[model samples]
Target: MASPLLRKPSLVHEGDATIVHQLLAQDTGLEYVGFKMIDLKVKARYEETLTDQECCIVALTGRITVSEGEHHFTGIGTRESVFEKKPTDSVFVSGGKQFLLEAVTNATVALCYAPSLQQLPTRWIKAGDVGVERRGKYQNQRMVHNILPDSDPSASSLLVVEVYTEGGHFSSYPPHKHDQDRLPEESFLEETYYHEVEPHTGFVFQRVYTDNRSLDETMSVEHRDVVLVPAGYHPVGVPDGYTSYYLNVMAGPKRIWKFHNDPDHEWILARQ
Candidate 1:
């Protein structure tokens, strides 16, 4: 039997005939985070109104124009491919805001969502505005692009980021969990990982497990697959010869993020 946490890619045609893969939220048992992968052709347009949630639209590849009310952002993408190791353009739309996305070229986008009652101003997050950092060392090394973090007040609850792991590397390692709402100690956040591999045929391994081993599952993730982490210590490992890229969306009752690494594996962090 396949793990319920792993969501395989399936096409759902929207009104504009855009190819969309709905991943998190919507009957997935996740309370906060929701995700969708959209593919659009040149000149294609998709309009939407976020009634009760805030959204971050990430341009994964190619170029696109986003319009919110009277304001329009033209030619808002930079990277031609995610593997280019460059930060791409993104837009943040708060609740009750209506927006339109028009593809300037064939493009792929990620829509990350979190419920919110507060209506914040719409902001275009340029590629240059994204904070890029190289995290970990040696085999655990990975590149991180912070599209929207807790420090950014632009969002009410949504926290978004993307990570790139080299082949034979580990990501989200040392296994951390944020399932408890203990304020400064840890926060209860629901998270979703949308995976994409460099060589489409390659695969990666992700494990979601709790302290008791009651909720434990190791998933063989493929291109465009999404893994949901409702509550657990989650870690990812990339096989040799296959690079792994994942876009993460997280949210909780509190907008802050505080995680606790698994004690058994915490020793790895102390190693020189």
Candidate 2:
């Protein structure tokens, strides 16, 4: 079964306002993998700049205009429908430089980055590009976003995927793990889950831990709750009432994210 690993939201102060950041993994004592999920409310006509970091933003609600110097990035406006995997208009700020932003309307955004400004090959995969598939006994249909390809043998350093789960369905059930880098089926890779629950209501459950030493944590993960996987098996499960959508951010020395499951439930793999 998948165990539980969760960290409380950390408060990050920027300008005169405040933003809540859910830190999933860090490169220091916390973990060499750097990851974070941030919720930002862009005030109308309120523009902010970023520097000394490489970042990506996903609009949660409302609309905003992102600018880099004279360059402009107009996001999909509200009431016009938001599309995933659309152009992520990106900006690079090396050595502590700031980038600029302005909100055409009140908006919330998610931003992610590495501390040293190390740029990972980033791409914007529209939700349209992901082929929806069913996994686990629940037969929950979900759209999986693959951030990295398996063709490059050297490219197995970090594997990232986002799953948009429909309401009233379950994913990551019959919990499994890849903590043992032993056989062809078992390869350990740290993982992270940044969830965006629809309607901003209800909760989801996520588990993580070693095979015999399972630990469970149930969090009311809403629009921006982040779950971390440091050194064990992790699986994310959503309840029946809410449509849970999450972005999985993973990074490790080995690029592959292979795993073994508790024999008790491993049989479910055959159905997939």
Candidate 3:
């Protein structure tokens, strides 16, 4: 759960992109997360100490140079990294604010600060490097992250990756809820969806609602439109005729996302 007082809100606007963030948590003492549109011609430097919380530094447009305690992580070409980066285990925390140097020609970067670190495993894989899996419908291709293997039930998560359909396909289909703390059933985690759409095109529909008489909300999202998964059966909907891409960042107390499927669509899980 997020602390209300620690919740800072803002709009991150750059050329051709806008990211709205509902910062549910922050570094132990820092109350505000950062959002900026920077330029390479001018070097940008930001420094802050982190509490127990973790932070995500995304190169919304170009590359960045990060210096942490006795280590430096270089992010090139619109790359991103968690402030407290974890290279192994798929789920772990470095737990610090650290410093960053952004030197992109013209770029917009989003910095997400949370109560703990949630960083994903990343490895560069070329096309044809591995056999592709046809796990989804529509034109969407599936390329599972090679770094993510089966983890312990007690582990924490950094990120989840999925390729969105080019023309109206579904990710997180059939609607499921991971808000409750259960044993091997569902785990509670807050998530962030970062998007990358095809040239001149954007995304469409995403629904978040509750089954226990809670109100539902449908949002028309575009590139970089971030939706908060706050205790509900949420589903991602891609409209017909446009290609989309996204990166999912998640973290919670349970450290696992155990879910209870809606009875209506429970059959889908069996197929997988």
Better of 1 and 3 by TM-score: 1
Off by over 4 Å in 1: none
Model 1, 106-150: lDDT tens digits are 889899999975878889998999999999988999999999999
Which 10 residues in a row give candidate 1 its minimum summed lDDT? Answer: 15-24
Report the CA-based lDDT of candidate 2 relative to the real structure. 0.51
- As a whole number from 0 to 100, the lDDT of residue 200 in candidate 3 is 32
Better of 1 and 2 by TM-score: 1
Runs in model 2 deviating more than 4 A are 1-4, 8-17, 22-29, 41-55, 65-72, 76-98, 114-138, 147-159, 180-187, 214-223
Using Cα atoms with residue i matched to residue i, what is each candidate's TM-score against the true structure?
0.97, 0.67, 0.66
lDDT of 2 by residue, 68-178 (tens): 555566653332122242222222232233444555555555554433334333233333443444444455456664433333222224344557666666566556675
Note the Cα lDDT for every prediction shown: 0.91, 0.51, 0.47
Give the number of the best model, judged by lDDT: 1
